[model samples]
Target: MHAAGLGKQSLLIPKQPLLLLHGLFGFRELGPFVYFHGITEPLKSLGAKVVATRVHPTDSIANRAAQLQTQLSQVLKQYNTDKVHVIAHSMGGLDARYLINKLDWERNIMSLTTLATPHRGSYIADWSVLNIKQKLKIESLFKVLDIPLLAIDQLTPQYINECFNPEITDVPDVQYKSYGAWKQFESKFSYLYYFGQLLAEREGRNDGLVSMDSARWGQSFNEIPNCDHINIINWSESKFDIMPTYQKILSDLYHLEQQRELKWSIR
Candidate 1:
């Protein structure tokens, strides 16, 4: 759709609060470098209570999940609500899933909408930790830099297939939705374009980092056209506008919530 056609007036507001969870190396608010730039305010203006959470930027999913759980408790108490709808980007989605499944947070989460998350795995992560020798070297470097490299390990296909998949179970009560994006073409200015090309060559269609197939995990999935990994969250940076896309997502959730309430009333 065209950018001009995407207006906030047409967007529907949901009853539940929205908690925005950022991806790996992401923060809640970093001065001018906010993770999901120009997103929360518009959502709030639409009559939705929006809260962007802060988690350990480079920590493992379990550790980040714990951090999110704590933040979630505070947000729920502040909003006086029992549950919240989550809009998580990239690795944040996996963190939310870990919280819900492994940390007993299923009852506290109403719905989860994942954007370009590596559900199965990312080839980049696989490449990084290709062999035991390489993994050890990378881990040592991260340790020297005082950065958590365990999170990187968790993103690999081997880790997800062997360790994560077995423990993390999807609860039937929680509503799940996922979205993927693909880079249109390569550009010398954009590093994501180069990565996208590399991934497309190696792992089929991908949004720079995460492949479209890897991002598809929830009950419902969507593909956003002409968007790279970073631009999928902030499409205003690219030629495509993401405002309409986000509005549509919120509208869909609003309708879904209405339907859920109606079903409860009917029962």
Candidate 2:
């Protein structure tokens, strides 16, 4: 939700660069269209250095992380930043978590902030997996199209609970933050609305695609009220501005860096 008077708020970012990550079936850009929509350019205009990166649209987390690591290596070379903050949405959050945990990015990464991410996996994935006929058809189509199907299996709640979460433990020094949207539309024609209803039947509150509970992770979790999953990226049906929240997060990162520096000095 876009809060009134958010534009009046002024926030500043430090020297640390920001890396923006997109979710499943996402891309940096397709012609004039962007995955992060209005986020990157606006942040850049504010003097915050940022990288909006792309990964395999549908691939295993390990594969996606490898791709991200390669890009991050280049980004570090170009920017010369000691540490960077990661802002990831949806399935990209899982990829970020994996990169940090298994790939030993604890030293280079200062923080990770996720929006509408399914940290605990989603009911939608579970339902999709259970629906064998449909799943098979879709899998066959993806195979014919040469798209990987392993990523879809990984998003199931069971996989995350039993296999993933245990492996992807968080580092103490790297701060983690999360945000979720719970608002859903009642429109019958919208696919998100339909998924929202499915999730709502058992999950209480959802953001059309992901449940708020599933979205929650890390040391802090914030609610973007009256926002759906896509709305978090500024492309949803609402006109809610997402820049303010992005600015606030960067401001917070700056403060956190100050605190870290002070701690290092004390030691």
Candidate 3:
């Protein structure tokens, strides 16, 4: 349930490619910085074909999902592989879900594992959509700034509950699992503390950006302790290391893939 019982070790070499999807305003890489820091090298070392995808940094869920689909399609064609294992974080998880369920990618994506994804929705986003007039005014502000704002509006509780979730259902036999990030609010220097405080009153526990309740979407729901939303991606000033957690996820994904394949083997 926590970021224990996990360590760096030789991992199962995946036959199917692994696709890494980033959250809101995420980039595959910027100079030396990467979205999933300390992730790609290890996966490549494990002989896993990894594709860290990039989509529009700030965009609507539909637009983001379309970009994801295009990238994945290109990757699949390039690698000559039909199956892929998707690991998504934050809003990227929503994008993955949309591609898999709404965009007819279920047959290609064998499994989806999300971390700190606001699958149900987030209170912080709801805070923005206080009322119709206010929300519209905010939208107008974004337009004046020449910034697209659908992604923010879509992250609210109302959108996911009444609109997105109702329309998107997990395809049968497509494995879905999710994990949450957990951290104690101790640093006023970090904004996550404030967000966590607000989420605590409404959603129990959170990883600053998304509540544990909101992070849960699929089957397995676990919390990576001592991790905030940013630290889960290994961008932390604290001592909490994220590589072990990622290792655990990759190992579990391999085993799950094997099991699924065995279950459906042409016996």
- Pick by lDDT: which candidate is best? 2
Lowest lDDT sum, 10 consecutive residues, model 1, at: 1-10
Off by over 4 Å in 1: 1-8, 130-138, 235-237
Clash counts for all predictions: 0, 0, 0
Model 1 gets an lDDT of: 0.82
TM-score of 3: 0.90
Best candidate per TM-score, number? 2
Q: Return the TM-score for candidate 1, rounded to 2 decimals.
A: 0.91
Encode model 3's per-residue lDDT on 153-253: one tens digit a residue.
Answer: 79988899999999988888688999998788977887677778888888887888798888977778888987899888778777567877777777887
What are the TM-scores, per candidate, against the unseen true structure?
Answer: 0.91, 0.93, 0.90
Candidate 2: 10-residue stretch with minimal lDDT = 1-10
Q: For model 2, what is the error of residue 194's alpha carbon versus the real structure, in angstroms, after optimal superposition? A: 0.6
Q: Show model 3 residue runs off by greater than 4 Å.
A: 1-9, 129-141, 144-146
List, residue by residue over 155-246, the lDDT tens digit for candidate 1: 98778878887888788999999999877566777867666776788778888899998899878999888888877666445556777778
